[model samples]
Target chain A: MKAYLKKYGIRLLIVVFLVVGILAVGRSVRDGGAGLLSNVSGAIRTPFQKVATAVVSRMEELYGYVYKYDNLVQENERLRAQLADLENQIRANDQAMEENARLRELLNLQQKHTDYTFESAKVVSWNASNWDSSFTISKGSDSGLEKGDSVVTEYGVLVGTITEVGTSWSTVETVVDLDTNIGVLVGNEQVSGILEGDYTLMRSQYMKLSFVAETGQIITGDIVITSGAGGAYPQGLILGTVSSVHTEAAGQVEYAVVEPFTKLDELTQIFVIKDYQVVE
Target chain B: MFADVIDFKKLRLALVYILCLAVMMFFQDTVFARLGLFGVKMLFIPAACVAVSLFEGGFRGGLFGLLAGLLCDLSFPESTFLFTLLFPAIGFISGLAAEFWISHSFTAYMATAGFALLVTALCQMVRVIIVEPGSALTCLLTALVQTLWSLPMAAVSYTVIKRISRWGNKR
Candidate 1:
């Protein structure tokens, strides 16, 4: 019994220490893996990493043209790979810079619109189909967002409305989606109609303002804004501008093509107006 | 000291697979996801698994499929076990196809990959139908696009594995 205890006691002690060590490592890694990793690594290896990076860059540079004359194929391959990597980096950096600028503009808008209570969210994944139009956002009901909330760009351009809200994600159905229709006023005169998403018009990145009076004076370049009828949307949010005025060749109602202020394809981050004054 | 000169053929094979999967995952998420064509990004994980199955045979194919599927599950967590289950089965079937009827060549690899990818896409389409019924048509399009995009990847993966095997043989 004593021999068994002696052997097992030491083994148990070692096992306990091993488990403790593993747990410590795991805890640290879990805590510091993201966000803190770059900063911490920079603080520790900034000088060394820079030198190492420079040396590797120079080596790659040398490797590219090592046998420019004799091994042209190899050289081309290396250069092409290097170019692709650099281009990818440039794109990522460009996206980051653009997002930063957008956030700044959003902050400015937040300050300007004091009555607008807002939550910001990043556009994450897009729906796979070209027919339907909705994109997922990173923030959702947990961020006080609900279905039917008004979403806008930094320039106060109405992008879409939140249609579905989950705990951590939400879906925004854009103006070009076939299901969307907003009550809108045309030009400075407030000529009222419904700005509707037409499948045909959406292909050209435009929506249709339908049900205009057959005699209503509408022209090209006329600004369109939300009418905010029935308290569905806040008043006077910019919908778009009139691109062209037309009446269906066989139909009675006049309609104008509206070019949306927000380019739905180039979106990344958007603001959800949670609460706003219901100006009728 | 004599045993120190032990065989490392299996180790070398494992290393090749690990390296291949790592590079594929990086391209799948970081690079290809950013390269939006028609607002849809290509999926590299299925292509990678298919290539692995064609080259490595049934057991290794299944193993690699498990890894690939696990990574996929991390991003799209809705159906946690769907990819994990589907990928391994596809990989195993691909290995059978490779062993029986096909030679270890780029052309064979491309054909086998196309078959495996089509099967996987069909599975995904089915899943989408059951889960999000409204998106089924779009999912079919997505699956086809994913398969089409994966053809070139099969060529690349075959070349890479072939080179690695040649290097292994040389040593």
Candidate 2:
């Protein structure tokens, strides 16, 4: 047994060491030995660490100064951008106020012509997803809003029709949706067209003047308005501007891309045309 | 040659272990990230501890493992306090085995390797229980894989330490 033990003594010693080492290391790690080591090492190496730290810090300060200079330059650029944006917003607001004054005058003119009642509604929220481009208004069923009610801005410009009615909220599906189709006429020219939405392109829809003869005198920038032919909307409501005019190869039809005057995203306030009795 | 009379073998072994621990701690993250196989990282410190234990006596070997593990935990970013306690416990257990039970044969080396693997796996299991109680499946799988992977390294370290110890005895 002694001879066998002698032969294996070294191996046995190693096994003993392995177990002890794991325990010591584990204990030290648990009890914040690292912080203690760092403190000790720091005390021993302070002069060198400090000198190195100072040199590095100075270099960092120089780099920081450079960064600050660049930051100031960027800040100046940002301020200039904000100034330009503010100027644009101010110009837009002024134009809107002037348009409002003009619309008020038009409202008075409209009152002389039609006995329709109007209720003002403020746009509160928009659908967050593109799958539904509908917007909600603060006025709803309580505000005499019902499905199929014609919605327009203060200037008698048709925006959309109220599709869904709730107690305190209503949804307006703009004419740009695929499901919407309104009979329209070119202002004063009396040229009739069927305004239908194109779902493929989200932004704009097609206003096809299918029966307009090829020789029909349609020009660019012509104003399109609701024809009041289908009794869905009041007559003479502004629709959009004629952006393009194309004659079919067969020479019997003409179509135009009418860019709406009012951006759908920017719509804030609108009126419901309440007293227009449907001619059904 | 006369300077060898002071028997700097123990000191040299201690220094080597210290150096190895430092290197392992410093590069632990890089090593672990690069060398993970089947989602298991090799526990290099435990293998080193086993090696040191087999080469040096139990006390020094266990001390080396404890220091190595402590250094590793210190260097790690998301380290917890439990590592310090657990690692040293593993070292003590392994070192006790090395001191009392190890034999000088091929079978002895294999036994040492198996013991080292078991010690490491046990430490890791305890850590998992404390840190993530419900993930027993993941903990067991990782611990098993790491233990297996550590075996070869333990063998190599054990061999190297044995050679050095023999060289020390010759002087």
Candidate 3:
């Protein structure tokens, strides 16, 4: 028995370890909490990720400068030509006025939600999984950022929510992630539905507003906002605009595709709403 | 006393390999994470594990795989142990294959890496399929695309690990 055990002990141990790992992972998933190992791993990787993010940003800037020099020159010449035209001044002034108004609207985001407390964080690194849409941010529990904090743009566009938190880092699961589901009201009629991240729509950076009643009036370009039905999310957070509506093959149910106002790929900084008055 | 118990040569090789692993992970999380191809991102760590396992034998390879998988799980959002369990097994099997059946060649490495990637993709798909049953076809397609895209990592990992292994073998 000892001889046989010696020969196959490593393999037996591997099997036992795998079984234990499976059970532990299942429990962790059920509890929705990461264990100590994950936290330690996050701690170890955060500094490296920060450094890498800084280096990548610098490299991108350098690459942009080197590659876009000719485009910049062409743009400069066109701008100079436009400076000589009378129509250009009026168009430029109009654009400037629109931009000023937009800036004011963005600034009002803070005033608009006086009950909400905000903490800003920079993206350190994105998740490497092709199946997930999440990124690690610079602040975590150390900054009083909790697991369910809603992340948003300065213009009050819903980005996502914090899914996991470490001491100094947290993972923000973007709205396009397959696991995201937020209660949303669609259109000016405010047809209530669940904004769910669909696997097919996620590829195109869109989500599905499912569970809509067939009689609901939802048209293309209709704005969608948080319904705040269960008080999990804050009310009136602008999620996106309805891009399209569809019906099930059974023709009994309807859904809509929403394109988010926030350009997720362009986000470098975002704000976390740690505490918000959830008005239903 | 510690030197008597541990081979300094192997320790040097292990440290260098860890450094290489860190660099690969850095690039995987930072650069490859953003470079989407047909809606799926590239994953290189599984292939890297295969390459290291092929050269390093079972014990070291399995240890490296465990480390790599832990890091991968850390980088994945809300993922606890998917890679942590899969990668060590991949490393052990690949190492055993290398010791008994396969040659330490690029073709052999690619074959093992391809199998490892397919297994990894399938495991990832299982969760999606369970949660979003309506998107089974989408998940399958994504799994295939992810596997195809990550195949190139085999060549990269093989070239890098082979050179490092050769360097470590020198007296």
Candidate 4:
């Protein structure tokens, strides 16, 4: 028995591993849920990821400053001149009109949604896979986050939805992830449609708004926002502007490409909406 | 004398390899994740696996492949079965091929590494292809670009592992 074990042990182990791999693949495809291995590894790696992200971010900032020093000097001089001109224009337009309007808008939004609960999280690491657009955040269920919670920018632009949460870290599937689907209203007509990530569009950091009626009047540069129909996402969260409109080959279907307001690549901090009253 | 009997050189080599793998994982997860060309990210782990396997032989290669595969799966947002299954197979086959037919040369390593990379790229897109048939062409193009972009990682792996292997030989 000992001799037999020595002879075929490698083969037996290979079989076992293949079985495990197959099962894992099946589970991943079936539900897209994290397994025990994922949870344990995530718990172990979260701290390291946080440190690495911080170090890399600092290094990038330093590198940018060093590399762009000369360019920045020249640009700074140009910008100073431009700033003086803009300041003159601003004084001429006077009443502090732009600042007043911005403050009023902020006040209106604050007064309108008095029930929003915000929890801030820093992005620790991006998903290493080329196939998906998601990132891990430093906050998780420990911070009162849950799967399906909406994430947004500080200015109330929709970023994504939390899909997987570990004890201390959560994965945010961004607005451009292939699996993300959100109901959106477009243009002044408020034409309703389902906005989803498309494989081709995602590479360009864009999403597709489909199911619009053939008669729907969504043109280029139209504002798109969350419809808040099903209470899944908050109403009036800025999605993006329409980049271009497209029609199906048969002309029976229409879709518009939306360039999201919050650039996914530039995000460092995000706010998760822990709870919100359904605004309809 | 005790160290020689226990082959301390091998032990030291293993430790160094582990350290190297960890550093590579760190860079792959953080630095490489942010830097991409034409929307294709570099895959360092697989290239490192192939490099180590070619020098270390089948048994060790397979083991390292398994560890690297697990890390790759864990690190990605959408975990796939492809890396866990394919990586070890690539390691084992590359090891055997190196032992029997191929020389430990840059050209040979690149050829084998390219094959491993192409397989990974194709396998990654199989689900996307099945679910979104219309996007098949775009996925294929992306996969090709990823494979091309990842070749420099293979070159780096070769240089690093070659130096390590030479040190082991000298000792």
Candidate 5:
């Protein structure tokens, strides 16, 4: 036993040290491990992983089906009622046509004012962790969306920005994210301030509007728009409405809370703003 | 008949290992997930480490560790491959440590568990150094939480491994 222990002891130590050293070196490199090792590991693991993933996915699908059955029934009933209402509205078609024309004109006006080009993308997946407010969009390099591109909804409300862009998928760090900041202008007043996320709440609760002079003409209910200050976002896009204002004792500088217009949690579709001319 | 017995043994062991791995992964996905207070995830690594230490030895243990780490890495989509390498290294080192520094005593098992916890803590530190050097304090706090949580998991894994090894030897 002693001889066996003595023989293998140093060998085991060497192996441990070698692995630790390799890992440390691997950490420095962008790729964790070399090609063959990673590829082999990936290949060997993929099938088993896939099986496990499939099992979990199927279980989740079943759970979702069962859980949403009641909601589905409710939604179906609601939709049927709405469908009947729409049918009745179609019978009295003149008013419906007028309303559609009015909506088309408003949409056209919105399009004319906002020269920003949009690429529509679907939200494919969301991070399971509620604390990390990020989601993956289907659009990527192939769709002409790149990192640092601003994302918004059809109503032109700020959604988030593309932080990491892969070939087929990209991650959007929403306005709710603690690290996010947007340069915004308040309504027709043109009162500019920086909008930032609050980490503590874990929601898009309030934005910290900073660097506005205390003497600057600022008031509650001012509509905040993208100033195109930082070149990350385009000019004249609606961000939110100012909810509250904060004043320092010195009265030289002030801040305001801007409630974002986008209902971030319920977002299913978003437009990646593709072509914003940088001011700088 | 002899070859059949050998095949049966190998198949049984493989199945047992897979089942253990599945259980570990489920706990990691659910329980450690909830424990992510202030970026600190509870230590699931030690469970894999302890299991590897007791049931598997040498290259096999290392491989199992690598496998466990890879599975854990899939949960974090952002940092794609970094965790894959770091965690396997922890497992391999912990298993190696168990093989070398300690004898097969209750104390040794406890010591192995402690070593696994230390390894997990060190791995978190290494991650902090590589990924987010600025967030060392946060990582350190998280490491401490992970280490604390790993003790009981390691003990349980030790028991499971012991039982599995006994069952393996019987056939």
Candidate 6:
């Protein structure tokens, strides 16, 4: 045994060093820098990470070009069909202009919780791991992006939450991760439930809205929004639209399938809601 | 003169291996990060290691694999040193296969790449099974996509490494 150890001691040492490196990183993520090794590693890899993200951004631009062209082609076909409805619809809408304005006045947001200050970030890379839905954003602790800060779209739709932070980079775990569970409110009924990401539903780009009372009747296409009950997220941020609802065989518990408002896959740039007032 | 020749050869090998690892990491992290073609993230570095192992030796490939693993662990918090162990083993196996059966031909590239990609897909499958068993079906599809995407990259790596080796031999 001693002879074998002596022969392969260096190799064993390297392996130990590597395992130690990962543990340190896992520990340091909550606090920012892992130790000497993780810090050094993150620093050395920073430039490469930046370049990797930049390449993706450029590719997204190219993809957007192709996507837009495809959309144009599809739009042309749809327009050919919809041309008959367009003039009639426009005339109908023009007549309802006063009613539309009245509805807008009623639905106009007053920003009851206006304490939100945001930091814009460019998605630098995605989690290559198949097990989770996450990505790295360019801004980090330097931008006041703390772990648990909310991430969102330009339209203030909830995307994910920051889970890990470094000096210049932070990882955002999307709402579709099985580990994510947030208190949510649904529809005009004010139905309350725990919105959670499930491993199975993730493939379909959906999440589970569970833990509702049997008294609450949820219909298809009902909008889900953050309830702000746990103070983890601000209230009224759009989560998703109800796709399906399910009831247990015992009928004691119920859950609704939610499809996110934003296409998580197509998001290249997002905003970090660094600070927000917790509404009770 | 003999000692100098050996030293130069070792230096060349190290340089080539390091360069391949760096470039592969760059492409995988930056380019492949966002371009999820067909729901699979392209793993281009493994192909580089397989190419070098075929063109040079197993030890060089294993070393490159080690760095590649380290790069993954350091960059992505979710990835652990299990990657470090896996990549080296893959490198060793690819190198061994290259030493025994491969030549500087398209067939060799295909064989090496197919084997390497198979191993990578296996790891991903295991990841889905062990870590997130619920995602197995979707992960399988992703693994297939990743393997297909990596095939062409492996061919490119084989061609590039072959040229690099030719230069090293002349020098």
The C-alpha lDDT values of all candidates are 0.77, 0.67, 0.86, 0.86, 0.69, 0.79
Which parts of model 6 are misplaced by more than 4 Å? A1-111, A127-131, A247-254, B1-9, B101-105, B130-132
Poorest lDDT segment (10 consecutive residues) of candidate 1 chain A: A125-134
The residue-by-residue lDDT of candidate 4 on A1-280, one tens digit each, is 9889877997899999998998778797869887677789999999999999999999999999999998999999999999999999889677357445544654565576778887878888888778889999999999999999998876788989999999899999999888878998999999889999888888889999989866677789999999998999999899999999887787654778999997898887778889999975
Q: Which ten residues in a row have the lowest lDDT in candidate 5 chain B?
A: B127-136
Q: What would the per-residue lDDT of candidate 5 be over residues A1-280, giving only the tens digit for each residue? A: 9999889998999999999898777767746555556779999999999999999999999999999999999999999999999998887696557545544644764576566667778787665332246778898999888888988876778878898888888989887665667887776668767787654333334566777744467778998888898687887777777888777797554677777787675676677888856766
* Candidates, DockQ: 0.03, 0.01, 0.45, 0.48, 0.04, 0.19
lDDT by residue (B139-171, candidate 3, tens digit) is 888888888888876689889998898899884
Residue A183 displacement in candidate 5 (angstroms): 1.8
lDDT of 6 by residue, A1-49 (tens): 9889887997899999999888776776757636776689999999999
Task: Estimate, for each residue in B78-165, the C-alpha lDDT of model 5 and write its tens digit.
Answer: 4456556755665566567668865655567677667667665665456335543544555555566666666776677777777877
Q: Looking at model 4 chain B, which ten-residue stretch has the lowest summed lDDT? A: B77-86
How does residue B92 of candidate 4 score in lDDT?
A: 89
Which residue pairs show collisions in model 1? none
Candidate 1 residue spans exceeding 4 A from truth: A1-113, A120-149, A161-235, A242-249, A252-258, A265-269, A277-280, B1-26, B36-40, B56-93, B115-150, B160-171
Q: Which portions of model 3 miss their true places by more than 4 Å?
A: A1-106, A248-253
Docking class of 5: incorrect
Q: What TM-score does structure 4 among the candidates reach? A: 0.72
DockQ for candidate 1, please give it: 0.03
Candidate 3 is graded, for docking, as acceptable
Chain A alone, TM-score per model = 0.63, 0.58, 0.61, 0.60, 0.58, 0.59
Ranking by TM-score: 3, 4, 6, 5, 1, 2
Candidate 4 segments whose C-alpha is farther than 4 A from its true place: A1-110, A249-253, B1-9
